[model samples]
Target: MAAGGEPVRLIMSGAVVGQELAAEFGPLPPAMLPVGVQKLYELQLEALGGTRQHLVLPEGYGLTDYDRERLARAGVEVAPIPEGLRLGEAVVYALNSIGAGEGPVHILHGDTLIAEPPLHADDVIVGARRSNEYAWAEIETDASGRITVLVDTRAGEEGREHQPVAAGYFSFSSGVELLRSLTRMRGDFIAGVNHYAAGRPMRALGGGRWLDFGHLQTFFQSRLAVTTARAFNTVRIDGLTARKSSRDEAKIWAEAHWLQEAPPAVQVYCARLLGFGAEAGRSFYETEYEYLPVLSELFVHGALARQPWLRILASCEAFLRTCAQLSGGGSGDAALKALAADKTAARLEAFARETGFDIDAALSLEGRPAPSLRAIAERLVPAYDLQSGAADSVCHGDFCFSNILYDSRVRRIRAIDPRGLVGERPTLYGDVRYDLAKLAHSIVGRYDQIIAGRCRAERRGADFSIAFEPIACQPWLEAALGEMNVRGVRGRSVPVQAVTVSLFLSMIPLHADKPERQMAFIANALRLFLELDSQ
Candidate 1:
């Protein structure tokens, strides 16, 4: 029971998310789609803030153990209902199965997340947003905020042009009343809503930010709205452009300069820089935004089929091979050593100081003996030094899957968000092997899965064990790694595995917000280091 004298049970109707979205985001419902590092349902649970949360899934919809675990952690119970039922019937079936009590029943369409939902109100409240799109249910409210008429605009109706519509959430006084209204209307959701509204004053609650993930365009737009930024920088997406700004002038300026100074071959593979500016002591740069799915998303979600995955890997191999040709003749060796040895050591030390993890101590990782971070760095000094006296080339310093966007329509890739620095210097070129290590870290290292919360790491003192939820593209990943290793860089054999492990160690401090993520990185680094040492 809540403080408002009515027990609130949040019913998230998942069947409405549709098959189109399901195909894009793999097997998950819209509620489970990744919004930055967390799921959409995770954000919704936090925003809605209730103890009794229930999800309604279509009949025979299978959930993985990982999915069940995450839902369990969030205290959400599942109710599977029969398929082919109308939206209203589905909600009623869900309510009957979950036993919605004599309290407030907050029905949220799974595809929508209201930032500040109007809950426990006296009147029946329907969440509203003003939009001209015919996909939504139109709502006409009187001056007193009561809904006079509600229409399902999807029935091929003429356009009202920028009217208030139901934003896929409604709060009823009790489940009993809602069920009666629904039963009377014969399970037509909008008609039931109209019937209920006619009997009682249904107010329009339209005060807060409401995100709709029902359509492809709106889905991407909502995802951008909720994405988390780095500690030092912020990115805002508006219309067809994205602007990244930072109080650290050097970082932002460097990113802009790298995009500008990239050669023709490199520029063809990256986002076009729109412009740069300074506003209120912050430096900023804008770029043309392409609403393409990031490789990380597609990879982790099992969204692309096996052949597409192979083609993407092939495309990436071609891009990196092209980059290797833009050599600066070993000028970046010193920078590479600084990054692989010096900066990595410093960052590991900083991570230790921040988390009290003792990186100097040895570890027993996954039943295998692992060396301390200091020892690993010591051995890697010579390994990274091997890249010296070899050809260096133009680099996308952060060439990981997450930084690359793939457009399936054109079968091309666009790289975004370069590291913009090599050992504290802002430059466009580095040892090409460093870029290879970044890609390896994503594929062989599973860095993006950790970022996407698809892995678990548990640590007891210096002993650690971690496992990523099984991804569907394992064979493709192995093939990609084999291709990369065989290709090497500029026909020179580089210690990519060793450098990839170091890359994981170096990025620990950058993700300090989630300690579990930091620990996952450490565990993954140890695992990779053991494999490298054995080889």
Candidate 2:
């Protein structure tokens, strides 16, 4: 009933359905199936009548042993092919061994699933769907449907309307001739079809349902579809329904999993904040950080209030957790302490090596009496230490105006965009002063220009009070730190005053324009540091 004469039908083995089909149609003469999956092939033999003649390729000689044994048992001839010969070559060899001898041999991929019985031997049947439905091929059938030209322009510019439809089925007139034709071609055998089709007439078969189950997603979907179809008497309706249901479930599951596994807010904030590096693709980590300000603004503006508090908390916790993880050695408290120590000198030393700075000279300047930057930094360090050491808990790394989200109407403070999580170290975790200093930086930094511009436009007058007063920020910082049990420094107007001064001074070199401001900042920082060191 199948092609190639001698009542022989060749089914490529190795894929999911190959073995099953082979066994079901057996007893005529078992042809050795491809060796892809042995169990499935054995199952196919059992399914078939078990009497089919199978032409087996040699073991490791291009065809697998499983197919060869099965075919040999079925009284089919076993042909040994060259080890490296391709699938098309092996198919041609098998056909030649079966007395089909060359000419046009139909080669089919092992994986294609067919729903109907194969066409007659003389007729070349190609699986085709509506052009709009599949869109893979440019098909145009002739009027009589007798002479069909399936053009495969996968390689050339021969822009034919139709492509050689990819159903795992083909029929060749002569096995040896087909094998020789394919052997001489530089391209793969399927590609050789284009040249073979040049003089031969090919026909297309429409009205059959087929599917490709190559990728994991597609494979699962196809398996589910097949299972559902087998269970239901009417496969058409049930298969479609199963596909839709599975796809929907997959999407929901994916979303839920993503939400559950979402990272911390701080990590997100940092990623967005940093954006992408010039050398790499968009840095997801940096993007999250960079976008924190926007997220905070949204929250403060009540855009995110509609979200559940649990969600907000989860995001915040994720950020803190991430920072703790990156702190190195797993000691969150130690990381905070080190950060608060203002070990910028050591960090700068390392940076100097990378940037070709005079590391020796910079270290020499440390503790050495000097004017300009060194003198001011030394003076400011002690003042900073006094204020910083008085805090009840660690504040957000840069809890400034930009990082704070506040509701003016409710007067509620919502801090977002945490840069790092500090551990409960007495020295580093004590104080609202560091936070206050950061707040000062935020106000006095570039935002001042924006506020000025806005004030000029409103004519309501830009007052520092609208943003934050230095005095008002102090209480807020103190209250925040107090809530965490930070003890205020005794007899000090503001806790961590020296630390704040040092912090402000550090910003001078990075921020100030005028020489006077720069000099003033350096002098204050040097004084604070020196005083703190002495203490």
> How well does each candidate superpose onto the true structure, as a TM-score?
0.88, 0.32
Local accuracy of candidate 2 as per-residue lDDT tens digits, 1-535 = 2334543445553222223222221111122211111222343333222233343433443333433455567654444444445666666556655665433344434344444424344335555542222223333347756433443434334443444454545655555545565666653565555445544555556425553433222333433433321111111223222111122223323322222233443323332222212122211112111101122222221112222322433343333333333322233233323444454344433434444533233221233443333343344444344323221443355555444432222333345334333332212122344554454333333232222121111111111111221222234333332233222322222334444544543444343234334333343344444444555
Q: lDDT of each model, Cα atoms only?
A: 0.76, 0.37
Which portions of model 1 miss their true places by more than 4 Å? 1-13, 16-23, 101-103, 142-145, 155-158, 277-279, 300-303, 331-335, 349-359, 382-389, 485-494, 512-516
Candidate that would win on TM-score: 1
What does the lDDT read for residue 273 in candidate 2? 29
Please list the residue runs of candidate 2 whose C-alpha ends up more than 4 Å from where it truly belongs after superposition: 1-4, 13-58, 61-83, 97-99, 102-106, 130-141, 146-149, 152-164, 183-187, 228-535
RMSD, model 1, all Cα superposed? 3.4
Tens-digit lDDT string for candidate 1 (31-79): 7666665667777887777577787777666666787887898788888
lDDT of 1: 0.76
